[model samples]
Target: MNAVKTGSHAASTLEKTPVGDLVDGKGHSSGAEWLTRYSTSLMGVFGTPQRVLVRGAGCLVWDADGKEYLDLLGGIAVNALGHAHPFVTSVISSQLATLGHVSNFFTSPTQIALAEKLLALTHAPPGSKVFFANSGTEAVEAAFKLARRNGASPDGTTGKRTKIIALEGAFHGRTMGALALTAKEAYRAPFEPLPGGVVHIPFGDVAALEAAIDETVAAVFLEPIQGEAGVRPLPPGYLKAAREATTKAGALLILDEVQTGIGRTGKWLATEDAGIVPDAITLAKGLGGGFPIGALLTFGEQTSSLLAAGQHGTTFGGNPVATAAALATLHAIESQRVLENVAVVGDYLRTGLAAVDGVTEVRGEGLLIGFDLDAEVAPAVVTAGLDAGFIVNSPGPRTIRLAPPLVLTKDQTGTFLAALPAILRTAKDAQ
Candidate 1:
């Protein structure tokens, strides 16, 4: 078989090929061809495509060129049960066939059931609530609104509390409201005059948190593990400390568990390990196991009632199909004992990664693993990993992140471990 082609020649070839010829599974188009067309037609925000993936199953995927890769990134922690999971797919299909969508005017049983299940799993108190959205950013946006709504004065008058606190390395999302809470100057600079009053404090600094949080503060947003910051977990006891400070200051403590929730950390929510029930938590990434569902769970009646009906809504947030997908995902996680698998396999991956020659350190819990290389060649490592039939990510110059499917097996992990040393060498050489 011919290797995938690239450059101007491939782009011209794609331009000449009939549009109908690009049909899926036909093997009539190459990765380079699809990517060239993609560059011309799509936005440049994400840059060029690495490989044009055609199909996926479990923890593996195939590019358009018929190349197979062990998907170690798991779509950046979105594909919890891995790509095209049978159970999730079936549920979504069935729901779509039966009743695909309904406006916010009416709610479906599946949607209600999912909300109830999330509340139960999080051990939320009576009168707690769940607000559904279509993505992590949407969920964060809703949480932002909830925080603002809860920002009322001690006597319940509006506008007294306006400030919101987020960590320095935090990545909430790219949407306006979510972006305002995000700390990266680059992401926020482009869109200036963002909804103000959002502050950034040093991550994992309890003293800083205590000093920054006050009556004027409406909420403190935290990610138990910062996935985009290279899977950096918060310092021990930080969650509890934040909880205490926020409670003392009468501010809400919101956990952004977009990448750490839904059993990604060997538990339903990473904050659970810290034994703190936050005022609100935003969840996505793995919630629907690649089906694109997000939610904000409020812990009690007061916080839950902050956003009254008509205050916030989404057209397709809790559509029957999405709810069904989320429900099926939860069912699979429980029935398959995937959380147990995450604990056992996660430890294995971490241990094996630490032993790799070029590895400097490993951080993260469950399947969401990240490691630092002795040398700053993470981008090169990602390239080498792809070339070696393994899919990985470089969140930073020195960090390689792995948030593979929760169902990833020990043997599959062993396969990557066996090949990592050579991939590292190749990366260093290329660098």
Candidate 2:
């Protein structure tokens, strides 16, 4: 075992031992060997592991083979301040040392502070409240419950307002309740008889949204930018329209900001871009800067009062360490002006990608970007990117998504831009 100091923090010691070497009393030196062990030990839901990443710092990660790649995906937009951000690391360590886990029967200062902070950041109205969860899916689950609770008659009944509306290309989460709201058939097909009454409408179609959302609807769910749907943003005025329709139809408007919130789009909430306040918003991903925390913010007294005591709860949600990490992540984002950096670097990448010969279109806001290729070679492009010391993702046959760290700089993006033409050429050749 070896001790390595990262960045300017010498007190922190990172173990340099290979993780594979410690498993099963056998030393597995390479990524392929560890992956072979992984197949037998882990479930196959996510397919093969892309790479056995050993360590990461800032916007870069090293694979088991010691190859370095610029991380453009940022752990699917979870690593907002980038991997191993020193401030977040220090806060977590300190919190763990002082007070780690406490059952939900009790609460800590950090938990209260985080809830207050989220409310303040979202500019939530008075009586707004926050419910902490362990991940984005859990937060969505809570929001689903909020919708159901809102639909209950004054005397408590179920079937009154049961229908929920979601868009054509939304990816809410994989949980049964969230899965019901998700628009993809492949994900929902396996788990049929899903909490019924979820209908999928065309993405960003105002008329369809207006028509689908009526008195019978309990809630209307939307993503400001449909990230898994090739980074497609809703048409302008779409969120405002949804808000209006839901309000008029007496339905709750819930925005899933799991991938787009917490400064991923240069704003605390992507809903801010549209200047409309929703009944509730689900957050995760960048909230704890990779420390695994999610939250559901319910706006106003009416919406916040829907879920009463004992209606929903979690065992490990809002623990001190997670909330402390979230506070540190928020502090770093503000003090370092990471949102401004996101705007500058995001524009640079979008413009450069559009100029590339093989790219047909580039879409997204801030650091959550996507582009289309001239051909259906997105998967090939992902492979070529990994091989060329860069990380990227393809959500569809012709679409590639890049949700780089909010702290990514223009210089780092220039490197990817310089390598992209060649990477695209290689992908096209492979296709």
Candidate 3:
């Protein structure tokens, strides 16, 4: 028998591979056994593993058992250009080979370029500033601190307007500051004592917003479309009303575009045609096309100056690699004409879902869509979809959420529609 090498770039034989693996009777690793190991080692925050996904390409992924699925959730709207996109991978690889990262104390061209590009995309006014972070939660947390600073008095000690207003049914993030703004009781109760002085008002209700936002309010946070709450778009003129109310009350309007922005809605910004400028905006999810980057953009000196030196900092927020990946994502969105594709294919998906017998209503814009099931069988429907080699999410017991890659094609949309009838039937039969 020959000696098998382990670590240090050496290959190992079948019997010599280190631990953390399960072998069946035939001596092959199994996904089910791996799930058992995963459960034993990792916390059950997200519950049991689905398939132990191994590889992905385009709008498809394969599980540990080599089963393929058309990824409709896109990792919960994180994979903007789908998986292992060549353009993004090339940029990330090139940037990493050239300069992986530099400390925040130092800056890189990729980071600076991405900031400028994002500011331009927002059509931000002069003197706007972008604070980079690593995830959607961090971006919201940064904006939370910015709002607190805005509430501070001239000397930066006392405060006149210390309260922040967030909409009910909002899903900002899971961090303390972000969670404080989120309205879900289940998500907040376990993590009590959240950053205080946060108030929740009915989403898109002009009257509730007006009543809550007063001169003593620091900021009002709202999502253009409630992503995790079943993709409910704001009523017309709601954002305009919020802007007028906040401006009159001397409160800043912060839009959490974490899930809705970056061309997900077939627009550069979901709030593009709303005709109101947000004091600040927090963005993430699809920004890096799955590479992980978040940003807080403050408009004008009024909001930008709130975060002075040493106010907020992140170590890996704007690393050169992530920034480069983001740049590629943005460029691909444009050069690939993906926004146009989203409009055509998204409408197709929306219309198809609407035509389904079990679908009650379809809500959302562009590639981000959610539908209500006539019956309370969304989980069953999702399971049926998985069994049919499709990927979807049940955000609520009756809500099916789909935030697929922006590059989803009309053919893929047709394929999903073709398979949905049986999936819905399976759910109904189970019920």
lDDT scores of the candidates, listed in order? 0.92, 0.92, 0.91
* Candidate 3: residue 105 Cα off by (Å): 1.1
Local error of candidate 2 at residue 20 (angstroms): 5.3
Candidate number that wins on TM-score, 1 or 2:
2
lDDT of 1 by residue, 312-384 (tens): 9999998899989999999999999999999999999999999989899999999999999989999999999
Q: Quick one: how many clashes does candidate 2 have?
A: 0
lDDT of 3 at 258: 95
| Candidate 3 lDDT by residue in tens digits, 200-235 | 988788898898888789999999999889999999
Highest-scoring model, TM-score: 2
Which stretches of candidate 2 lie above 4 Å from their native place? Answer: 1-28
| TM-score of every candidate relative to the true structure | 0.93, 0.95, 0.94
Ranking by TM-score: 2, 3, 1
For residue 404, model 3's alpha carbon misses the true position, in angstroms, by 0.2
Which pairs, if any, clash in model 2?
none
Give the least accurate 10-residue stretch of model 2, judged by summed lDDT. 8-17
Query: Model 2 — TM-score against the truth?
Result: 0.95
User: By the lDDT metric, which is better: model 2 or model 3?
Assistant: 2
After superposition, which runs of candidate 3 have C-alpha atoms over 4 Å from their true positions? 1-28
